[model samples]
Target: METKLTPGGIVWKIFKIIIYSLMVFFSITFVGIFVWVLINSFKTAPDFMQNALGLPEIKWDYQNYFDIFKFEYKNNNLFQMLGNTLIMIAINVICTISFPVMAGYVFGRMEFKGRAKFEAFLYVLMTIPVIGGASAQLKFLSALHLYDSYLGIFILSSGAFGSGMLILTSLFRGLPSAYAEAAYMDGAGEFTVFFKIYYPQAIPLLSINVITSIIAVWNDYMTAYIFLPTHPTIALGLQQLQRTADVHGSDYPLMFAGIILTMLPVFIVFSFIAKNIFNSKDIGALK
Candidate 1:
């Protein structure tokens, strides 16, 4: 079949071309900057200052990677800061998956009195910015003695609400109820129906949520700064490292090295889960 392009089709094609061009331009710019930083990270302070935009004159300075571990901020070494960041990221991912799974399944699949109102409430809660209640939240956490503690941060981040809830709820609703009904006919318990049946099906969506939570929490410094002054995460530590580098002067290469090191974990995590996220078949399957 031959089709002629209409005026609207021509306009849409032009729009798409413009959008793709912008995307390509920005992607190249980002990669160029990243490569420049990586190349400079290998050079000495003076070498970097002399040729900020050029490649290294000598072999790569592998020591810069090791030196990152030795860098300290407020008595917290790189290892300690990395550990703190990992802990928070792990807690955030777990809570985001687990809490949303249970809550979303219940509200999405089951019929119960006041369920509509509860869903409405969750939607309203999403409208409220987290920072809007920072003062009260800080006071509340302090009153409960959760401030500056891992458990406190875990609890604070483990709310069974927000955009994730809405997404999971919709995901559950899209699924056929026959699966759960069959499991029930076989005398399966609620736990089996949820954990064994539908939960496994939700893994793809959950993986996406995990990646998002990890990246968000990994890059988050403000929350940790106020709630956990004693336990600085990688992001907070990076800020401190930058300040310390500035004080010493001519240590921008080392600061860039730290930035690369901090970014590596996020890249690794995303790579591992990227496959699962893109393959929607795993999530779309009835089984």
Candidate 2:
């Protein structure tokens, strides 16, 4: 059975083809660049400049990677910086996840006076784009004596509101009240009911948020630059490397190697999650 394509269907097919072609083209471009960088990472500076985009014809210098392990910024080595970044991510995840879960339950389930107004206020706060606010924030932090310390960064990042609150609000609001009521009837307190029942239900959303926060924190250098200047993370170290390269001549191949090393962790993590992103269970709907 041969069916002729209508004009509208033909146009739609052309549109789809164009979109697919662009995606493939960009993917190839990205992969090509990545391969070029990786190839250069193993070459000597002279070799890299000689054949920037080609395979390493000179000695396959693996010493570049070893040099990165030895690299230091502000007395913090790569390992120490990695540890700091992990700590930052851990603190953020704990704060962000725990606070939102509680807030979501309270705002979504418990009806109190001015509850709607409070929720509205949170929304309003989210809408206000914070540009710097550095002076007031510094003053406040100085008042508390938390400036330039791990605790200060922890306190700042561990806020219990904003985007996470909104996301989890919808999830908790849609949850059935029957289970909570049953738990209450069984002499369970609010905390117990929340921990035992509601918390388990929101694990999927929480897990995804944790993964996202890890990646964001891993890539973030600006916050660390401001708050944790003494303890530079991988991203911050990369920035320091760039500065050093500019002022003092750097081994270009070694710099490329360092760049790739810093990128690999986040790249691996995102790749792992991206594959299973859609394969996971349907989110928001509780078991």
Candidate 3:
């Protein structure tokens, strides 16, 4: 069966080919970089320098991976650092997702005065970077006596004006209002209507927020470096390992190994949710 292609069909095929080619190119580059890092993770500093793009010079290159656990950063072992990271993820995830979803419900479903303006304000603020005010933030944390504390970092990271707010807002808006009306008819109050009627439906979208927070909090080192001096995370520990590498004299491979371990959790989690997170219609995809 032979069929002649239209001009539009031929153009579409060409576009498809170009897109596929780019995906393949970028995928290869990404995988190649990761593989290179993994390979280098096994090599000694000298071995890495000598055979940057090749296999490890020595047969037994797994010692660096072991050294990660053996070495301690400021008296905090790698597992303790990992524990701190997990705790941070839990606290930050709850703080970040909880308030936004609550506010998302209010502004999203319930119409009120200045709602649109408030939403606009959040959108404007989103474009503004908070990087410049690090000193002020540090001072603020100190003023609250929360300096170098988990609570301080939690408060700092849990801003409501983020994509979670926007996405969950849209999700709530797209939901059926009839459920709330039915709840109200059953003598349910606002809290009941929200908790019983609406909140459950939002789990999928909220999971996205949780997943994002987990990855973000997992990778965030600066906050821990600044505010959690007592607790070191894998991300911050990796940097500390590099900075102290001269003193250690051979921890470069250990640093590389730590890097791999640090990214492993995020990589595994992203693999599962990449399609959903990357989807064009985020709210619609959940529904």
Candidate 4:
């Protein structure tokens, strides 16, 4: 059976088709670029630029992977650089997750003098631009003999005292006090209630916040550049590579290899947590 469409309906349908086509085109283009990079990562310098947009012209040069780690200057291996990046990321994740959870719990549950003042302080801290604080933080770390150290960068990145507090405070505020009250009546102390009741309920929000913090820290370059000057992270290292290439011609294959390596961990982590991060479960409903 054939159904006839009105002229207006036909026009509308055509518009919808065009819109969808554009969306698909853009999506494919984005994926294609990454695919190109991934494939070219396995190519030699000559073949990479010559046939970058085409399929691999020869056997996948697995040596590209080996060469990346092997091509070292000044006795620094790429593997060590990757380890440093992972260490920084790990520190950021720990501080972002733990500090925010406890601070959020306090802001949400505890009643004490200067509570409002402390909350206000957090808000003020959030308003201070990160760039402005970098110099002063570096100096403070220097005074404390923490300059050019992993601990210094960890402390700077992990100072999750502001945005994390805000996000968790909102989540905590939305939680029902009835649960805590009941726990209190049941002979549960403050710590007991927080650990046994509140912590369990906050997991979903915590997961989301942790994922967010991970993405931020992973992509961050300025802080890594300024504070971790001696210890270059993936972001800083990539920037340095780009600068080097600009000065001394391009090495497309090596560049693409570096990019693919840089993005692989983030892709894996997000793929694992994508389901939970996007889950629609209500944190407040957790009993």
Each prediction's whole-model lDDT (CA): 0.85, 0.82, 0.83, 0.76
Give the CA lDDT, 0 to 100, for residue 244 in model 2: 80
Q: Regarding TM-score, does 2 or 3 come out ahead?
A: 2
Question: Candidate 2 clashing pairs?
Answer: none
The alpha-carbon RMSD values of the candidates against the true structure, listed in the order shown, are: 3.4, 2.8, 3.3, 4.3
Choose the strongest candidate by TM-score: 2
Estimate the overall C-alpha local distance difference test score of candidate 4.
Answer: 0.76
The clash number for model 1 is: 0
lDDT of 2 by residue, 1-287 (tens): 98899999999999999999999999999988877778889998788777877788878889899987888999999899999888888888888678878888898778999999988888888789989787777777889988877788877877777666666777888889899898899999978998999988888777777777888999899888877778888899988888887776647778789889978988888786774556655343332
Report residue 147 deviation for candidate 4 (angstroms): 1.2
Give stretches of model 1 more than 4 Å off: 1-15, 129-131, 275-287
Scored against the true structure, residue 95 in model 2 reaches a CA lDDT of 81
User: Which ten residues in a row are the worst by lDDT in model 1?
Assistant: 278-287
List ranges where model 3 is wrong by over 4 Å.
1-19, 44-49, 120-131, 246-250, 283-287
Q: How displaced is residue 212 in candidate 2, in Å?
A: 0.8
lDDT of 3 at 78: 91
> TM-score of model 4 relative to the true fold?
0.82
> What lDDT tens digits, residue by residue, belong to model 4 across residues 18-120?
9999999999999988997898888877777678677678767767666667644334467767777778778877887788789888887788999999888
For model 3, how does the per-residue alpha-carbon lDDT over 43-92 read when each residue is reduced to its tens digit? 88788767788888776488878778976888999999999999898888
Residue 26 displacement in candidate 3 (angstroms): 2.1
For model 4, what is the alpha-carbon lDDT of residue 106?
88
lDDT of 1 by residue, 93-201 (tens): 8898899788989988889999999888877877777666778888998999988898888888888876677777888887898988999999999999988888988
RMSD of 2: 2.8
Best by lDDT: 1
Cα TM-score per model: 0.89, 0.91, 0.84, 0.82
